[model samples]
Target: MPTGVLYVMSTVVPGLVKIGKTTTGRFDDRMRILERNGYNNVTGLHREFAIEVERYDEKERMLDDIFSKARVPGSELFALDINLAIELLASFEGRQIYPKTSTESKSKVFDDAAKNHQENTDIQCIPEGTYYLDRKRPPLHVEMVVEDGALTIRAGQRVAEHDSDRADDRARELRRATVAADGTVRANVHFSAPSQAAAFIFHLSSSAPNLMALQKVVA
Candidate 1:
């Protein structure tokens, strides 16, 4: 049987490192997904090394030795730049190299009053009208367009005239979204009380560029 060490770690562009491990090889998929989603230039390496111990404790000791003898990020032992082999080994530590399955990586956001929507009242609902939106991905702020019956989402200079179903899905997640008959989008979007709603709003604001413009409309 063939056996080898599996590592799961992440590196900072320019320079930084996060190390990890796993028993399986799924880490590769995770790294790919991250790259496709936005994180690029990541690399994974695997290699075989000799073991001097047969017992479990002995093997543990050997791993510890390798760690101690290497210049891993947080390791206090060994000279900072002297361990080439250890640096290579440190690459796989604590990082997942693979992307998770769709089911596993799907967006976890949804309607849940249980999550504290006090601040939900703060999400300003743009009036029913017309506006532009910049399309990209989740966490990217959208442009606001107030109109009647339906709302238009835009990406870049182009409006996302299509994907109404998906757009509606996005709208519904907003507790303060409403659409009116006169083509007016309205919402109070209160941002106070429990920390979760505030956190969620902050997250959306920071991650999504122009989300305040993508205010959900309601009727």
Candidate 2:
């Protein structure tokens, strides 16, 4: 009796991992099937590793339990780093596929995410007009275009001004991200609370960016 081997997958959509079982040796085919099927949102998919095991369903259940906390609200995807995700999968049976990054890099990743969450600030600038943002950390701040009911933000060619951890560690989930975009992150919101939209796109505190009076050139 040939038992199916369970495979773990990773995608470029940050903080999302996939766990599934494949009976075929060419697991890429299965990935393709998934890409064309339900994973339409996943642009780039990477094969982490396929471990042969007994009772694939049991293995799937076990992985689910281990990552139950990181699992997305309504999907098979788990909100976790691909490397850390692989490590967790390997740890199941004492398997040793460690994370890609070294210990220092891993620590920095978490640390940065934590710093970003803790340093959230309230919006201080007055709203109601267009302006450019300037932050110290994520050097490249994008353009801001204000309109009647919605706000449009261009993407930053460089990283955010203030880089920090995004793991939501220590219950630090601050703002609501309306849209996750490449060149820009948009939020259909009211100007009265424009900071909400700004905080989300730049991944900073609402008050950090001069939402109202920063670079008046945008006015």
Candidate 3:
């Protein structure tokens, strides 16, 4: 069974919530992605809570059924208001969050990231595409193509993430990306949100999902 993280979120609006899942290490990345797109007319999304489950897909469906009365017109989003929505989640929670494996000190995390970067300087996962993000002057972005669940994050693009555990965890995956004439990053990562993809390329924090705005150049 694929063990992963299940996230339940709500927006500032009264009656809407989101339930989604992702890999354990990629939860923050996933949330940043959803929080970016979770709101309809609100500032952003607020996570109600999240937990790691052995059968995440099954749990999601189970929650969907339990809250069938609050089912909304769209996907995964429920119509239950925030207060009751969160309460229902707590009541119907099937499993608890995954336990931490090891908690590294902030300094150690940075040190380990630097070492991993130096050690993984040769691997590159490059693809072909003229992808662009932002229409501003000197828009910060990458041009890459996807193949076999892997892709290359181009050079010339830089992303600065926070000095928190979230960034430290993401850095491990970021280090393996090899920079080439075209790619400064190459790795076996997949992002559901375009924003998430952009953040991954830029090495930003899990909030990358909220910050990226990449678009295809359409050559």
Candidate 4:
């Protein structure tokens, strides 16, 4: 029955996180060593979340098993969502060690980060309008709009039809779209930066128009 700290570290690569455990007394020393020399030659390793708990070894093993599919072979790295990892780690019963906040919960960390991100990057910088895919015959359309003081993107496939068909097909498309509380169809995704949005849209459609262009097209 050893008391130790379970820590999650973020690597230079996005979506890659490391989970490990160290004795309470050696926690600070271990972190310093990892940060200074790097782990397995993986530099830029920084602690994201950590907690002191009883039987930290077992907790670490449990987390490894839970995220086994996402784990990198022969490494502690896991290609997992950072926020989800933080939320799951916070759910465990322990004293939050990293972040060194007045409150033990990590929700405040996320809230503050989001607030700072929104403040520093003006979402309104991008004009509110419809942007079509960068193709002769675009298959999808992305509409930018301001709702509740936040910029939102509503994207869906482009369907061509007559007026009667539009009434029926458009309604169906809206029904499938993610609806806000105000009955507005929102894509249900938020981008901290235009580059992030461009990456996401690129994943959806390789030929899709990027946010950098800021070209408003009527389709």
Residue 133 of model 4: what lDDT? 27
RMSD of each: 19.1, 17.6, 16.6, 15.7
lDDT of 4 by residue, 103-154 (tens): 5445454334333434454444333444432323434344444334454455
Tell me the whole-model lDDT of each prediction, alpha carbons only.
0.28, 0.47, 0.47, 0.55
Q: Which candidate is the best by TM-score?
A: 4
Worst 10 residues of 1 by lDDT: 105-114
Instruction: Report the C-alpha lDDT of model 1 over 145-180, residue by residue, as the tens digit.
Output: 433433333222221222233233333344224333
Which sections of candidate 1 miss by over 4 Å? Answer: 1-4, 8-10, 13-15, 33-219
- Looking at model 4, residue 87 earns an lDDT score of 45
Q: Give the 10-residue window scoring lowest on summed lDDT in candidate 2.
A: 167-176
Q: What is the TM-score of each candidate against the true structure?
A: 0.19, 0.38, 0.38, 0.49
Tens digit of per-residue lDDT, candidate 2, span 1-219: 445656667777865778777765656688677755546476566665555555667657655664566777666777654544333334233212212344333333333423343343212212334645455543556555555544545443322333336423211242224333343334433322334444554555443323221342321
For model 1 the TM-score comes to: 0.19
Whose lDDT is higher: candidate 2's or candidate 4's?
4
The Cα error of candidate 1 at residue 163, in Å, is 73
Candidate 3: Cα lDDT at 20: 68
